[model samples]
Target: MQIIQSLSEISGRYRALFVDLWGCVHDGVHPFPGAVEALKAYRATGGKVVLVTNSPRPRDGVAEQIAGIGVPADAYDAIATSGDSARLAMYQGAVGTRVWHMGYADESDDGFFTPPAILDDPLAIERVPLERAEGIVCTGPADPYADPSEMRPQFLAAKTRGLKLLCANPDIVVDRGGRREWCAGAYAQLYTEMGGESLYFGKPHPPIYDLARRRLAAIADVGDASILAIGDGPQTDAAGAMGEDLDLLFISGGLGAEETGTAIGGSPDPARLERYLAETGVAPTYVIGTLR
Candidate 1:
């Protein structure tokens, strides 16, 4: 993979960009000014920008959350979220009607329960207790800071009942302002390891990529060859892009900063980056320290 300093160096090669949200455009708590500017600049060149995120929040919720953190609307043309894709599946009876909801009780994840507007005759879902439910819908753990092993007992019960879990976000963990926290994928991984079935609709999975393509199609008729997938997650973004046969620009400074020896606003150590990529078995088209 070729290492570049800025996106402008290769921006002319693609017609659209499938940019990741967390760890690319924002740090969850705030926006990355350079990333935001880079997106705006790309859009100015008549290129489409689709914010493909694994956030469990719906599209509108994600838009609001990013706006609250200073990520302007002009940076991207559209958004496609894993929550929306999973919601569509849930409403289509991927999971049974009576489902057990596993997430924060503070109502921060309330938007996940909303039905997608595209579904005309959506299933009538009911949130019942785990023992009485037919399936489970997981947005994330009730406490992101806690270990996923703590859910073993609950996962065992669900497995015994043969309940299927619909995972909204497939991100194992994300750095929110430099503080790493667990995500829904970690819970799903643990559940699956315990013999429970977990269905994912996020990055590294085909469902979310389909949704992102539809979002891009609504704006312009762009093909897979003209799209560049950009993100920091090797397992999610890199894997997803490879699966879809799209060119990828891997940002080594996000999750791989420590392993790549990349300082803030600085490029990664060439030797370290090569070693890291070799270990992950991911080959991206380009590499950048940050989105800018």
Candidate 2:
């Protein structure tokens, strides 16, 4: 893989970018100034940026959250979230009408249940007890910091009942600032391992990419050949970009910093980076310590 110092080295080659938000742009609590400037500069060159995130929040909700975190409105053109894609499946009855909700209980997660305005007719989805539900809708664990194995009993019971799980965010974990936390994909992986079915809508899976392409198309007529995918997650972003046959710019300073020996505001150690890429089995077109 080519290790590059800045996005400007190859920015002119792509008409659009499918950028991951959590690690590449912000660290959940704050925005990365260099990353923000990179995107803004890219936009100034007439490039469209589609923030394709595996966040379990709708497009507008993500926009609001990012804006609150200091990422300005001009940094991106549009957003396509895993939540919106999974919500479309849920409202289309991927999980039966009566489903059990698994995630944060607070209002911060309420946007996931909101029906999409684009849908002409969405099913009347109901949040019911797991015992009475036909399927499960998992945005994430009620407690992200807790071990995923803690849900084995519930997953086993759901499996016995033949309930399918619709995983909104197919990310195993995310680094919120400096703390690592489990995500919906961890729970979904556990459920599937226990012989339960899990439907994923985010990265490495085709659904979210399709949704992101649609969002990108709404702004520009860019094809996969002219689009670049950027993210920190090796499996999610790198694998997804490879699956979609798009070039990838892997940000090593985020999730894989420790493994790749990437220090903050610095590039990764070449030997460690090669080993990390070999182990992950993903080949990114370009690598950078951060988005800039």
Best by lDDT: 1
Candidate 2 minimal-lDDT segment of 10 residues? 104-113
lDDT: worst 10-residue window of model 1: 104-113
TM-score list, all predictions: 0.98, 0.98
Model 2 regions more than 4 Å off: none
Candidate 1 residue spans exceeding 4 A from truth: none
Model 1: per-residue lDDT, tens digit, 1-292?
A: 8999999999999999999999998898988759999999999999999999999889999999999999999999999999999999999999899999988656566477777788899889999999999999999889889999998988899999999999999999999999999999999999899999999999999999999999999999999999999999999999999999999999998999999999989999999999999999789999999999
Instruction: Give a tens-digit lDDT track for model 2, residues 57-142.
Output: 89888888899989999999999899999999999999899999998645466478888888899999999999999999999888
CA displacement after TM-score superposition, residue 224 of candidate 2 (Å): 1.1
Cα lDDT computed for each candidate against the true fold: 0.93, 0.92
The positional error of residue 199 in candidate 2, measured at the CA in angstroms, is: 0.2
Go through the candidates in order and give the clash count of each: 0, 0
CA shift of 108, model 1, Å: 3.5
